[model samples]
Target: MSHAPTHVTCSAVSFDWPDGTPVFDGFHWAVGPGRTGLIGLNGCGKSTLLKLVAGELSPGEGQISVAGTLGYLPQNVTLDTGARVDEVLGIRTTRAALHAIEAGEATEANFAAVGDDWDVEERALATLDQLGLARIGLDRTVGELSGGECVLLRLAALLLARPDVLLLDEPTNNLDLRARHRLYAAVESWNGVMVLVSHDRELLERVDQIADLRDGEVRWYGGNFTDYEAMLAAEQEAAERMVRVAEGDVERQKRELAEAHLKLARRKRYGQKMFENKREPKIVMGARKRAAQESAGKHRIMHTEKLAEARERLDQAVEAVRDDAEIRIELPATQVHPGRRVLTLTDLHLAHGARVEGEWEVRGPERIALVGGNGSGKTTLLRTIAGLLPPASGEAVTHVPTRFLPQRLDVLDDGRTVAENVARFAPHASNNVIRARLAHFLFRGARADRAAGTLSGGERFRAALAALLLAEPAPQLLMLDEPTNNLDLASARQLTGALESYEGALLVASHDVPFLESIGITRWLLLDGTLRPTTAQEVRESRWDG
Candidate 1:
């Protein structure tokens, strides 16, 4: 597909938060046609840049120019539940005008409203169906849809507009597998200029190119996420090699400087002996001494300059190496014995009225993945297991200390700082201890002092995870519901790394297949009416029919 060239251009753009935290300063970017996946670490201003290009935000400096009509789907999709579908699709007036004309009211105003879109309803429905929302009638209310459906519906609206440029931020955050597939198809079919800001590897693979947003600037890559990673790995390898060479150069320069100093000292000692022995006239000896002293000073200056240059090169070489390290969390006390039963669900009935026909036992440090579609009662089951909700029929019990991280991350207290929140969970732990552990979760120094309410999406997730894993009694059974929902790629990998150090049993309910696989899940349970044992391959390859 051929898209207009230079569809979006941002020049010397700068933006800052109300608290004076800088995001971008003199940033410049130009995106042409085809799908461009915008990827970066969390809180790097990828979403903010998209918003600026969509005209939802004004830059504090510079200018952004879009060549044609622009459409944007923000990270969070929320619509009035009471609103009609047509209103959400942004075609209520046109639809009503067409209906009025059909009803024999041939007013010029109605004709103007209807204008070239006599088939707007058909197009809207077609777009909905294309996004796997065929059952969602045009007259239906927004309240009748599921969370994943809402995202697709919003995308359907944008598609109906047929804008020249489309900007999507984290479009697959809450979508399930099937919905993600539908979204992927939509992206593949997109013919106009599309810039997608996402951490989803699969969705990014469908893009024609990648715009790596880092340090408030965009770095263009010729291919998709996989290609970008490969290129980055090669670049890192070359940088590391350069760093090694620079270190050697710095050491050589230092040694040469030391040798020159030693040689100059020996020459001074020899000159001193000749002066004392009266080998020549005192004036001649003094003149020779002066010349030697001046030569020594010049030599010292030359060696010092060379050493400084070598050290500067070493500094630049070190800076070229990336510093993307995963969090290193150590939770020895959370380990569970292989023979010990961590959790038992005996003919359990969920809080949402879903029942498990047979008993399920989690032993040792087994990692369990709870797979289900939207409205499959996964959260309710987790809540029941955590004892936050009463079971409808049978028993849900945990033999060891347990912790639950819900989809909303309600475990955190928004009013308190991250340290205070963790302290709330582990009151017996001292402030120093809490800060120490939070540091392991990548929340060092003043970062831990930030209020939970002020944290970005990824920061909040990390804080919540820290609180849960660092709680007193060392939760032996940890249950997480959609933990990766709003996490960027780096944050998700960080979560997986944190879990790697957790020796306890894990029951994670999520639609993120790659994440579940990364945590070394020992078992998979498909949660429909009953918890059926399944395989990771089956989960990844097969479609969810329920």
Candidate 2:
């Protein structure tokens, strides 16, 4: 039985950029009331499509119907840096309410005009509580909140509108482990349609369907990331086989053309001999000459045409469909022999403002994780280990050379070429040596010639790593701070795989659960002004528990 139609339905969507470069060409998608991830590489038409659905941009052609209410959380915009968290949450509705209250005109009709429902303090508190923000003071403002907190508040405020559909752009960009989990939980429990666009694999995997936007087409797969990968692999294999067959056909056609030309040459020479010998009457000889000439001309034309066709086929066979994945990166060898016990922090003390005593410590050769939300000092502890920040008072001994990848991506030289950046970080190496190293990081050919700032987020990572690989004596201790930020799924997996092969010790401060699991992280040291060791399972189950 056919039921009522959905709120979102687009027919024959097509759009082009300012210069007439096609962005999305004749794409169609019907979004029902459920979570569907709008997956694509960065700069794919996901954002453009989102604008079309939100009615921000008119489609170049076709009809787009979006019924019911819509809630949207954009990727980035100007925010009140000096305002507190509470004010940002309540600013729009709160100001209207305040004006109503101050005027002593708190009429029911007035409240209805401001928002869909009456503007009540109790109702605001209820909504806040539902979104995990009950106790927060409205007067506190947005300035006090960090990136993750601000994102959470923005999401909470949108959810309060109780929209029929929610559109989130990069929802997990600035979130940490706890807050990411919080968002995942909220989305999983949601009843309305959710269209989420994010680069996070773990986040994308949770959605119902994934769309791969490439070359102005929406190649959507009807499942999660795994299913997409499986289908892609099968298709790539099929394409590979087709290319091989095409190559063989091209070669066979070339051989046949060559044989035909050889036969034509023989026929022409035989005709010439008959003409010279004068073996028949002139008229009969003329007819024979005409026939030979015609036959020779046709063979030459056919052979040349066949050769041209074979060349075209060869070109097609070489450039046929193929998956272009940029993931092959090599990790540098450890030069500094990890001295027995490369690093040791026993009965350590760390503090946010006040010290949490004698509860934290780690040893060498251990692949440990330091996980917590923003302002929780995961970065602080990583810095402490890297010797960037010294301890207040603790027995911290580090015998190995350590390299730290900061969250800010400062290890790379933004002004220089990718190869130059690598050389700068690794000053001891020659130019050729440095370029080779950069090439191994997948910034090969013209890509390595590009400036560091000009590269994509994933390419920037390779440049940073190229420099880090030059750590003197080869650091046996590698500490990465949020290494998974902005990384595509394939790149993240490749980086994780490379790290897994390293014999050196690793301490990573990351919210990417899938990456941590893939690289074999054992116990985690939960960061909350202090460090506490716990199992991976425990970290996943609890929320905001110190």
Candidate 3:
């Protein structure tokens, strides 16, 4: 069977901020069949580019041409709160609206004829059920379901659309271990072109190509995040060597220029005090003047050449990514004196219509990692610790001041401006102090005054963390639930670098194996119905999912 070919062509595409500051400068890339992962560190414009592909936002200049339909899953969905899961799937109401239009419901006669619209609801419900969203509460309010559930609900709708090209932005954020695995499985079987952005290295390894974004440019490779990192390192090494050679040339020129100036000055001083025509001295003076002029001219030419060499060297030095490391916040000091027994859980149980289960006790600077497949209880464990969910039995104990940064940072107020949110949580802080604190997180000036709703994914995340740090005495115990979800590699490294030197104890639940390992986790706890220490064998085999 011969099938037609289609493509998404973006030529010389560019976008700008409201103030006309360029976000993308003549950026261009294309998409085709199989899995294509869009890689970038925070603020590199991945989300904005994705918006262009989704047709939610237009470009400032250049043309973007798509030959077929598009399907997208945004990083976050704005739910009506009162809407049911099936109703949110698009199909439920789509049918009634189409039927009404077909019957000319705009005309008073057909409006009465199209009574009780139940026909499409059944089919929508069936489509959702087929994707394992059977018990997703077709009637439950959107506000009642968990973050993971909302993401899954949105996934169902996108799947039903079946567009020629699919754009998924951080689909694994806020998801537990088991939930992440399920997402990968679904993507692996997808029959259309996919362009995704995720920090989950394990997830990216499954894609066909990895396109990394850094310092406002995109570079693509044939493998996963790890593979891309290796290539990046090699390229940087070569660039550095070139810079070193350029520096040598620059220095040589500077020295020659200085010598020329000195010679020219000496000759001028001698000539200025010339006592020519003093018998034999007149002939000697003439010879000296002639030689000095030649020497001075040669030096002058060398100096000019040196200046040009320096400029070339500076240009070569600009390729280094070292300056892009953002996040300058003075993270709350980690060094704390927590009580001997920080936390102890004596046989806690989470009832899913069964007997007692889930039991464990964690205490003292135990850098523990909770790992499991998607749908496993990683985030649930984090939540239970956060006190959002109650244990069915037993008890959870903690003796230190704790703070939890959820996968979605839902702790922040979406409707509030960055400053307002900071002021609300850190009311004791003076206006000047609060602004300075937010500035360190890169919210800077007018951007900090903008409502949280208007910020990009990276900006929202930075604001959320800034709010947490504003408390007078920072929390001594830190809990992070998939903190790397929507963060690009550069942002993730900036965050991880800060956390490594932090003085507080940390309990992390993440699928970024490389990052987790870098932080030097002291132990691993795999979540089943209960929490238990992982075996050495399991640790050896743990890798970014492929």
Best by TM-score: 1
Error of 2 at 365 (Å): 5.4
How many residue pairs collide in each prediction?
A: 0, 9, 11
Model 2 earns a TM-score of 0.75
What is the TM-score of each predicted model, taking all chains together? Answer: 0.94, 0.75, 0.76
Give a tens-digit lDDT track for model 2, residues 1-546: 023444677788888755465666777777887788886654456767777888888888888887677878876533687766545565455556657766998877556556644454556566556555565655566666666777777887676667787888778866876667677777877777788877776777788877676766667777877887898888778777877877787788778878887887887788778878988888988898898789878877887787777777667656656444544444446523434566667655544432346534345467888777676777767777777777676755667778889866788777788877776666788878776766656666777777776565666776776677555566677889888775666567657765755667788887777678888886677776556666777666656442
Off by over 4 Å in 3: 1-3, 19-21, 77-153, 222-227, 276-302, 320-322, 326-333, 344-362, 371-397, 413-454, 526-546
Q: Which lDDT value does model 1 have at 370? A: 94
Could you tell me which 10 consecutive residues in candidate 2 have the lowest summed lDDT? Answer: 352-361
- Best model number under lDDT: 1
* Predicted candidate 3 versus true structure: per-residue lDDT over 223-325, tens digit per residue: 7667877887888887787778777777877877787787688769768677443544777877877887887777687679667968676676755634554
lDDT of each: 0.88, 0.70, 0.72
